[model samples]
Target: MEFVAKEKGFIAHFSYGDLHVSGDDEHGFRPFQLLVSSIAVCSGGVLRKILEKMRMPCSDMKVTAEVERNEEKANRVEKIHLHFVITGEQLDPEKVKKAVELARKNCPMAQSVEGSIVLTESFELVS
Candidate 1:
């Protein structure tokens, strides 16, 4: 990925599109937002695949993330809590929980931040 410096921040150009990154949200996506998003989205993607493989595919899944930051430590990210709401028919709660566990274990983004950022995942099934 290549990033071009702008007056306020940087814009990363990729095959998908351009991503604006900055310290301030007004300029673009904050660095912490991107980092947390990467972890949540990556985990969700892996979970989707795991569900399909387990024959428990969901019609929809939404991941909500809550981040904890330490103000004294340069506002560093301390923990991220991801709650997943899964909508599907005849879904097994136990299986979905297992899939979540597997996703957290396998997601590259989460693994990359392992031992540095604390991650927690929880899921609820809706028919």
Candidate 2:
């Protein structure tokens, strides 16, 4: 697997395999962005299936990540928080919580960052 990045002003063009991405950040999907994105995508995929199995059909799901860096480190993310907003009809809070727990345990991304970064999660439900 090879990845390449080219800089063009504030945006950087990135290509890897069949994936193409452009980002305003200097390094494109910087380490932190890639890390958080992994977490978001992994959890999202698992929860979608879990929700379906629980008979709670989700209409939409969005995952947002907020990372705080340590001043001393200058460029390292010290802590990260993820928010999962789920929209569906008659969603069960218990099932949602359980799904999140299961995802955290099974998601590869979450497992990958286990010892490196601090991760926290919060859930929101919208009717």
- TM-scores for candidates 1 onward, in order: 0.97, 0.78
Q: List per-prediction Cα lDDT, in the order shown.
A: 0.94, 0.78
Clashing pairs in 2: none
Off by over 4 Å in 2: 4-27
Per-residue alpha-carbon lDDT of model 1 for 69-116, expressed as tens digits?
999999999999999999988899888888899999999999999999
Tally clashing residue pairs in candidate 2.
0
- Runs in model 1 deviating more than 4 A are none
> Worst ten-residue run, lDDT, model 2?
8-17
* Candidate 1 structure, TM-score to reference: 0.97
